[model samples]
Target: MVTDKEGYAQLIQYLTEHLGLFENAGSGVDGSTVMELFEDLLAAQIIVVCGQNPELSFSQRNTIIREVDAIMYDLEEILAGCGRQQVNREQSYFITEFTGLVKNLFDHEIAQLVR
Candidate 1:
């Protein structure tokens, strides 16, 4: 019963696929995009676990926290890495859109958990 919107399935796909980043960066997608995608998926998964089994593994809980922190760190890195005026302008917009998706997904899960 996964929603086809900006929900868990899409977030999981992003983590596995690491979209919005290099397509063929070799091996696997880099950390910034991977972490960003992981964060959203972890958050959604945590909320689900907390609902179904609040006594999730301690390691799993820690993983959720770490993934969320990684997202913030990666966002800062992505913002700072955009060098050159023209590239910086475009990247800044892209970062905003990327972050907005993450924020909306997290907020939606929080709302679902609350209800």
Candidate 2:
């Protein structure tokens, strides 16, 4: 289902695992707060994406994926800036290059974060 809640839930779960934002409490002083904000913002984006027709066209899907890629990159940079995490900018962008929301969902679930 392309509903907002489903996509929001998936992104939360994915971020929980990959970013360890929800699990790792002893990370930093303001890190948890930032992570929470990130979740809220990401969920908000997903809500808009899900509001669109579930059966999105190729360009629609790709546009959403691109938006998601950009959002994730920004969040990752924020985390890295605060020394809470380390991510390779080039590597992350590469993931977006081949990222499609349907098949590579495990790796691209965060790409559902679209406005």
Candidate 3:
């Protein structure tokens, strides 16, 4: 979210480019609800990044991270393929990088209190 549309676009384009190698990329992209969840996470990103909600517990925050991690892992599993596809998997780690991006977005003050 901090990187804005350009950042998100760049990541999406990277993903789509690699996914171009997939025999059934479109179905994979469209059939899953994970993409929609990513959109939801992006929408909620501001809250987590800014530490906007005092009521959000550490467990809750970690749970959010775990959910995102699971989604990314599932995506990576779905993407597993031919030897050449390994390059794409490596390149698309940006999918999980979303978690790092979210974590990094936390304010310095907020991050210390997170754990």
Candidate 2: 10-residue stretch with minimal lDDT = 94-103
Distance from true position, residue 55, model 3, in Å?
3.2
TM-score result, candidate 3: 0.32
For all predicted structures, in order, the TM-scores are 0.36, 0.33, 0.32
**On residues 26-60, what C-alpha lDDT tens digit does candidate 2 reach at each position?**
43433334434444445554555555446666676
lDDT of 1 at 38: 37
Worst 10 residues of 3 by lDDT: 82-91
Could you tell me the lDDT of residue 4 within candidate 1?
A: 38
1 against 2, candidate with superior lDDT: 1
Report how far off residue 54 is in candidate 1 (Å). Answer: 21
Question: What tens digits encode model 1's per-residue C-alpha lDDT throughout 14-112?
Answer: 533533443223332233443344345546644654465465556645644665566555444543332111222333344445555665655555455
Candidate 1 accuracy as TM-score: 0.36
TM-score of 2: 0.33
Instruction: List residue ranges in candidate 2 displaced over 4 A.
Output: 1-33, 53-55, 83-115
**What would the per-residue lDDT of candidate 3 be over residues 4-111, giving only the tens digit for each residue?**
335434544555565644543322432323344344554466455536657667775675556445544544555555212222333334444664464454443244
Q: C-alpha displacement of 74 in model 3, angstroms?
A: 0.5
Candidate 1 Cα lDDT to native? 0.46
Compute the lDDT for candidate 3: 0.46
